[model samples]
Target: MDIATYTAFCLTAGPLTILMVIGLWKLFEKAGRPGWESLIPVYNVYIILKISGRPWWLLLLLLIPGINIIIGVGVAVDFIKSYGKFKISQNAAIILLPFICLPKWGFDKNTRYLGPSATISFHEKHRKDLQKSTTREWAEAVIFAVVAATLIRSLFIEAYTIPTPSMESSLLVGDFLFVSKINYGARLPITPVAFPFAHHTMPIIGGKAYWNGIKLPYFRLPGLGDIKKGDVVVFNFPMDADSPFYRPVDKRENYIKRCQGTPGDTLSLLNAKVYVNDEAAITPSHGEMEYMVRNDGSSFNRQLARDLHLSDIQQFTNQDFMMNMTAQSAALLKQQAGIKSVRPNIRFNGVYDPEVFPHNPKFRWNVDNLGPIIIPKKGWTVKLDSLTLPIYRRAIEVYEQNKLQVNDNHISINGKPADSYTFKLNYYWMMGDNRHNSEDSRFWGFVPEDHIVGKALFVWMSWDAETHKIRWSRVMRMIK
Candidate 1:
C-alpha cells in the first residue's frame, strides 16, 4: 500500500476500532465477565462467542478473510439479542453503528443481561416475542443471501464473461470465467455504495448503479504475488476518464488483456513481435494475427475455415486473401491443395499510425512496430519534456490527480515549476493477444495500478454462439 492509502486507513479505521473495543469492555462487565478481556484480540472473540451461546469453533472461521465478515455479522446480531434487543432496526444499529449502539446499550438503565440468545432454552422462554412470520423469515433469508454473495464477490472471486474477441483463441468469446481477486490481492471497494449484482449500470434501467459521493482511497489486502508478465488481467478502462464519461475509478468499464509490460520494463513491438527489455517476449500458443494468404485462383472449402477457426476473411482478388488465424493454422493451410503462399500482414517500421499510443506523428509507432518506452514504476522519476510528456501526461495528470500546466515549453505540476516528476503508482502495459484486431494499450497508453480489478483464473463454461452449442473441450479450462 502507498503512504497516502495507509494514512487514510489509519485515520478512519483506527478510531472506530478503539471505540468498539471500549464499548465491548463495558458490555463484557455487564455480562459478569472481566472488562479487560476485550483488550485481547482472539480471546475477545471467544468471550463474545461464550456470551452469545455460539460454538467456540466459530473462532476458526473468524480467522478467515471473506467468510469472517459474514460470521462477524451473525455474532454481532446474536450478541445484541442476548441483551433483550431483538428488533430489526436494533440489529441493524449493532451491525452498522456498533461504536454508537454498543455504548448506548451498555450504559442504558433498561438494558439487562438476558440468557444466551442462541441457546434453545432462551428461545423457548421468549418464543412469544421472538417468533417470526413466514414472510419475515423469507425476507431475512433473502437479505442474508444478498449480503453474503456481495461480500464473497468483493473479496474472493467473481464471475465474468468474455464479451469481446480481444483475447481471441486463448480466451474465446462466450467464455464464462471465474476471475480470482485474491491473486493480485482483493481491492477494497472504492465506490462502496452500489446496487447489488450490478456493475456500472442498472439492469434494464439505463442509469448509474453506483454513487460516487462516498469514494474510498485505493487499498488492497496482501495477495499471493505481484502481477507477472503474461498473466491475463481484468482492469477498468483508463479511457473512461475522458470525454463524456468521467466515471469513478472502480465504475469504469472492465477490459481484459494480457500483461505485456510490467513496471520498470522497456517494452516494444518489432514486426508484430513483442520485445521486453530487448528480449523477445513469450507469445501465447493460441494467439492469432492477420495473415496474408495467396491461393491458385481457387475458392477455399467451408470446412477448412471451420477447422482453422479463421475470422475476418477478406478477398482482395480471386487469388489473394487476408484472414485472421493462429500461426499453426496458417502452417496447416499452407499445405492444402491449390495453396501458394502465406505471409504475416505486418505494418513496416517507421510507418506512423495516428491511432497508436502517444498518438504523435513523431513516434512513428503502429500495431506491428512500437517504441522501447519504459513502463512507470512507483517512485521512478522521468524527465518532463516535450517527448516524454505525451506518453506520461494521462498517468501523471489524470490518474495521479495532479494539476499540471505547460507554458512556453515549461512544465509546472501542482503550481510548481518542475523539470522531472516521480510516479506515485506503478503503471503497466496491457495488450491483446489478437495483435491486429485488438484495441488495447497500443491505442491507449498505460494501465495505472488503481485501475486493476483482478486476474482471470479459468473458464468455467464456453458457448459457441453461432453453433448454438457448448464447447465441451473448453469447459473448466485453466487460463495460462
Candidate 2:
C-alpha cells in the first residue's frame, strides 16, 4: 500500500486492533471477564469502561470531535487506576505508549491485577521502576513528546511570529502570536510525513522538510466557528499554485491579514478604503496609510519619527516626505512646527497595474480602486464569460481542482462546455492594515477556505529589533 493508504489504515484499524487483542485480552482475564470479549471492537470498549469504573454513557463523549481526545485521556487515566497502578509515571506511560504499558501491565508475572477496591499502596512497588529510565525508555519518551506536540500543534494552537510589516500596527513584525486552530477548524496536513517541528524548509541547511511521495486530500475537523469579516486570519499563500514547486496548501508560506470580504460578500476598494457589500467597512483601529508630507524645504524630524516609532519613513524629495502613519500619528506629525501639509497618498482610479489580480489590461484596476467582485461561497455558481472568467479562473482551475480551458469566446471545464461553475470551496478576500506596503488578496486573489490556518489569538512575546529590547506593553496583548 502507498504511504497515505498505509497511514490511514494504521490510524483506523492497525495499532488499535492489536491493542484491543493484547492489552485488553490479558486485562479482561485479570478483571474476571471473558478474554474473547476483547476481540470485539465496540464490546471491548464497554468491557474496558466497566473495568475502569466509568459509566458506559461516557462513550458518547468519545464521539465528539475534539472532545474525544480528552475522553480518551480520561479513559486511560481510569484504566491505569483500575490496575492499581496509581503512580503519575504509570499514568503518563499509559497515555504516551498504551501499547507497551497496557501489555506490560497485563502480562507481566510480577504485576498483579488489583480490583477497583485496590489501595494506592499497590503502586508503591512500581514507582522505583518508573524512576529508573533505560535507553529504550528515554528513546520512547522523546518519540512520545514529538508525536504529542505535533498533534497538539496541528489541531489546537500554533506559535507564529510576524516576519514582515504587512500587518503593521495591527500585528507587528516582531510580535510572537499564538494562532488558534480551532477557531476556523484545523486543516489536516496534506503532506503528513514530514520532519518534526519544521515547516516547509529546514532552517540554515535549507532543504524541503516534507516527503511528497504521499499526498492526502484537504480535510478539516469541525471547528467552533467559521471565519468572519474584520477578523484577522492566517492562511496559506494561494499564488503558489503553479508547478515546479507545487506546495501543498498547509506547506505554503503563512500570511496574516484582515478578512475584508467573506464568502458571498461583494468587495471593492475605493481610494484605499475597503467596502463590503456596498457599505464602507470599518478599518482596523490602528491601521496605517501612506501620506505625502510636504516639509519646509528641509529634512523631516527624524528624531520625532523615531520617538513615535515610525521606522518606515522616507524622504521622497528635499521638501516632500513619504511616510506610513496611522491617523493618530499623522495628526501628531501635522502639528509639528516645520511640517507644511500631510495628505494621504491615494492612487488615482482607472489606473491599471500589471501586478494586480486578474493581471489583464482590460480590468484597469489598481490596489486602491479595484474589485467590486463577489467572493465565492461553496455551492454558489457564477457564469463564465470573458469578464467573469479572469476574476475566478484561478479559484476554479487551481483551488477547486477543475480543468479549465478557454478557446476564443468559449469556456469549457472538465472536457465539457460549461457557461457557469459552482465553487467547491468558500473564498475570502484578505487585506493588510499597512494598505500601501502590503501585498494581499487584492494582488493575488481570493484565499480558499482550505488554505486557512487559524485565527491570530495573542502576542505572547514581542521584540523590537531596532531597539534591541523586548516590547513590554505588547507582550500578552490579545489580538483584535
Top lDDT hit: 1
CA RMSD (A), model 2: 5.3
User: For model 1, how does the per-residue alpha-carbon lDDT over 208-294 read when each residue is reduced to its tens digit?
Assistant: 999998778887877789999999999999999987988999899999999999999999999999999999999999999999999
Q: How close is candidate 2 to the true structure, as a TM-score?
A: 0.81
Report, for every candidate in turn, its global Cα lDDT versus the true structure. Answer: 0.90, 0.84
What TM-score would each prediction reach against the true structure?
0.92, 0.81
User: What is the lDDT, from 0 to 100, of the residue 217 in candidate 1?
Assistant: 84
- Tens-digit lDDT string for candidate 2 (1-480): 225556786686677658747977898888899989988877888877888777999888888776677678878778777777765578778875787887877887766666654544544655665564587678768866886788789989999999999888888889999999898788878888789999889888999999988777677989989888888999999876667668877788888999999989998998988888899999898888788888899766778987665656777678987888888888888899988898998999999999998899979899899978999999899998989998999888888777899888888898999999988788999999989889998789999988999999999999998889999999999998
Q: List candidate 2 segments past 4 Å from native.
A: 1-44, 47-60, 70-134
